[model samples]
Target: MSQTNNRDGSNKRSRILSSDVYRQRENQSSTNVAQTQSGLIIDNETALSSEIIKEQLNSVDDIITQAIIEVPTKHLLYVKELGDNLFVSLSTKII
Candidate 1:
């Protein structure tokens, strides 16, 4: 999905539909398959770019990305924790 630049240059966040995100994922999957067939390696840096993450999580209102202090190239993507119990559950599921 191509995003249009605002003429006013304001930092306005637009709401992305879940369907759009799903379509984008499908397109990427096909491209990745082609790349893999051609012997290309998808590295961490390419796979985890901020723009890609933002596009993937566009429908999520509270998506966040925080760089690992020791590893600038690595980041943790998550939503804000609403509560301790919720965090525990999410972490458990993720792990």
Candidate 2:
């Protein structure tokens, strides 16, 4: 099966294949094969850029220092509690 969409002012087609068909076709075409093998097609450059963004977001020491430097001491408690809850929720996964 295939689906078409317009992205960035250009038309693109996404092809979907079942697992057995995918394995049979894997070595025949390299253009989109790796992506299908991994279950989804994501541009490599976009993935690398987002990884950099994620590293910055998870920098806890910088976040804490900035909060203490800019926010009132009384508000620090609220920030801490929110951070703790956010951490717990992010680390837990639904099955």
Each prediction's whole-model lDDT (CA): 0.51, 0.59
Model 1: per-residue Cα lDDT over 11-70, one tens digit each: 332234555665676567754443344567554333577877788777675666664454
Per-residue CA lDDT of model 2 for 1-95, tens digit only, reads: 13333452243222323555676676555643256655776443424467788988888785576333564577887887787887676667868
Best by lDDT: 2
Per-residue lDDT, model 2, residue 19, is 51
The most accurate candidate by TM-score is: 2
Model 1 root-mean-square deviation = 22.8
Kindly give the stretch of ten consecutive residues in candidate 2 with the minimal lDDT sum.
8-17
Please provide TM-scores, in order, for all candidate models, with all chains considered together: 0.17, 0.19
Instruction: Give the TM-score comparing model 1 with the true structure, all chains together.
Output: 0.17
